[model samples]
Target: MKTRVRSADFLGVVVKYMVLFIAVFVVLFPLYISAINSLKSNSAINNLSPLQAPSHLDWHNYVTAWVGGDLGSAFFNTFFIIILAVLGNVILGTMVAFALTRFDFALKKYIMGAYLLVIFIPTMTVQVAIFGVIKDLGLFDTRFAMILLYLGTNVVQIYIYMQFIRRIPMSLDESAMLDGASYFRIYRSIIFPLLAPATATVAILQTIAIYNDLYSPYLYMPSSNLGVASTALLRFQGPYSDQWNLIMAASLIIAIPVVVIYLILQRYIFAGIVAGSVRE
Candidate 1:
């Protein structure tokens, strides 16, 4: 009986990890293939053996991709848009979340209900409405337009922050008030620090969203030269359409920021997700 129990446990563990390994391979194999191809010479790209290893690693593909593709300028422009969008989402999202969760205001229930309803509706459904507004505001084709669109689309994220904030004890607020701290002061000095884990989660999520987003840039910013990494990757394919090396190189570069961010915030992100998931 004891031997059978131990065997069952060992088999379960093996099965679990086998499934995990397969899932990881499914997700990462493409990226691994791209990275390997990016380092291969033109002739190696044509050879099936390049899948094993490049005969000689060619680093110049990275430089050529950056310069010839105008990726450097695209990187800077993308950086500016992402920075602005993340800042706006964090600051405004936090404030909105705080108000919705903590403050008691008239029509609060109605507003919250409306927000919840809107969350179910896809933003694409409102693209016509939003595009008109952007055009009327004369922000079409500007970085500000992209930033504003990101802000408007962040309602669900703000609601996530609000849900997490609500789980925090209201007594903390009462105690701060009793100690003579103004609401703003308490938020700045106390509440904000306590919410670091949640903020980190929100920031990481929005960073990935803004960084990886291509459709918004394509729709609003018509200038091919002013493209983000996603749009810029299109340059790798042309009428001929077979420079897999350069395409892979651009993709690897674009993926770097997301991977680095996940590495840095892995713990906080996990903590936030677990806490938020199991909590009321």
Candidate 2:
């Protein structure tokens, strides 16, 4: 019986590993194809199977992508927008979450419910209204407009912060209050520091969101000079639509920053997610 049980356990382990191997291959296969094809010429990519290795590396694709796509300007614009938007979202979202989670104000429940409703409502439904407001405010074709939109759309960030904040004991706030500390002081000194993990989580998530966002930038900031990385990639598409290799190279270049940022902060992201989810 012990022998049979041992064999069964070994079979289960083998099956688990096989499943994981298949899953990893499924996820990584497309990335592998893209990387290899990006290093090939357009002719080579068209003639060869996507799974085939390149005969010789062609670095010109990246050069053309960088110059023709105006990636330097795109990166600068995207970085500026991301930094400001993330900062604004983190600050405003944290403060609002603190209020909703800690304070007892009239209409608090309704306000929370409204936020929940907003999360469910698709942004496309309100795009026309938002575009009209931006035009009226003279923010069309500007980075500041994108920043404002990012901040306003951060309902999920606020909710995440609130979840983590709820896990923190209210005794800290009470003790700080007893020492004559004001609400702002308590938040600044005690609560905000405790929210570091959640803050990192929000920053990383928002960075990826803003970086990969194509439609928003395309719609609001359509000026050729003001294009973000995603929109700038469109430059490779039109006349040279057949240049799949160049397109792939440009996409890889655009993705590098996001990949690096995620790798650097993945630990913090996982920690924050776990910390927010599990209650003591």
Candidate 3:
């Protein structure tokens, strides 16, 4: 009976590993194909199956994609937009969250309710109205418009920060107050430092969202000179759609920064999420 039980447990472990192996393959197979094909020439890609490795490494695909796609300007524009938008979201979200969680004011409940309501309402439902407002304000083709939009649309970040802030003991704030520290001083010295994990989580999320956002930048900043990586990738299509190798290479280039960032801050992301969720 003990032998049979041990056999059953061993079978379960084997089955679990098999399932994980299959899942990993399913997720990674496409990326492997892309990476391999990105090093091949157009002719090689046409003749060979993507599942097969390239005959020889052709580094020219990256060069052609970079030069033809004008990726330098695209990357610059995208990075500029991402930095501004993330900064705005982090700062504004932290302030609003701090105010909501730590202070008492008139209509505070109503204000929190409004933010909750905004989250439920899909942004697509009000996109046309937002577009009209941007047009009227003459911000339709500017980077500032994107920054402002990101700042105002950070409800999730604010909510995350507020949850994390609530988990912090209010006694710290009381002690700081007793020491004659101003509100800003307490925030700068105590609250902000403690909220580092949450801030890292917010920055990672906002960075990915803003970086991958194709529609907003395409719609608002349609000028070729102001094109972002997503929109510039479109240039690799149309007329050159057959250049799959170049397209794949460009995609890999664009993805590098996001991958690096996630690797750096991934530890904080899980901790921040768990802390925020387990608290009030």
Q: Rank the candidates by TM-score, best first.
A: 3, 2, 1
Cα-based lDDT for every prediction: 0.78, 0.87, 0.84
- Taking all chains together, each candidate's TM-score versus the true structure is 0.88, 0.90, 0.93
Query: Scored by Cα lDDT, where does model 1 land?
Result: 0.78
Candidate 3 lDDT over residue span 1-280, tens digit each: 9999999999999999999999999988988888999999778999998888987999998998888888899989888988988888888888898999999999999999898888878766777788988899899999887888877765688878988889899999999999999999988899999998788888877788788887778888888778788888875676468678888898888877888988888887676567544534
What tens-digit string does per-residue lDDT give for candidate 2 at 99-133?
A: 99998999998998898788879776788889999
Once fitted onto the true fold, the runs of candidate 1 whose alpha carbons sit more than 4 angstroms away are 1-13, 48-50, 271-280
Cα-lDDT of candidate 3: 0.84
- Residue pairs clashing in model 1 are none
For model 2, the superposed segments whose C-alpha errors exceed 4 Å read 46-48, 271-280
- lDDT tens digits, residue span 15-97, model 1: 99999999999998988898889898788888856457686888888887877677887788788988888878877877777
Residue 102 error for model 3, in Å? Answer: 1.3
- Worst 10 contiguous positions by lDDT, candidate 2: 271-280
| Top candidate when judged by lDDT against the true structure | 2
Model 3 clashing residue pairs (backbone): none
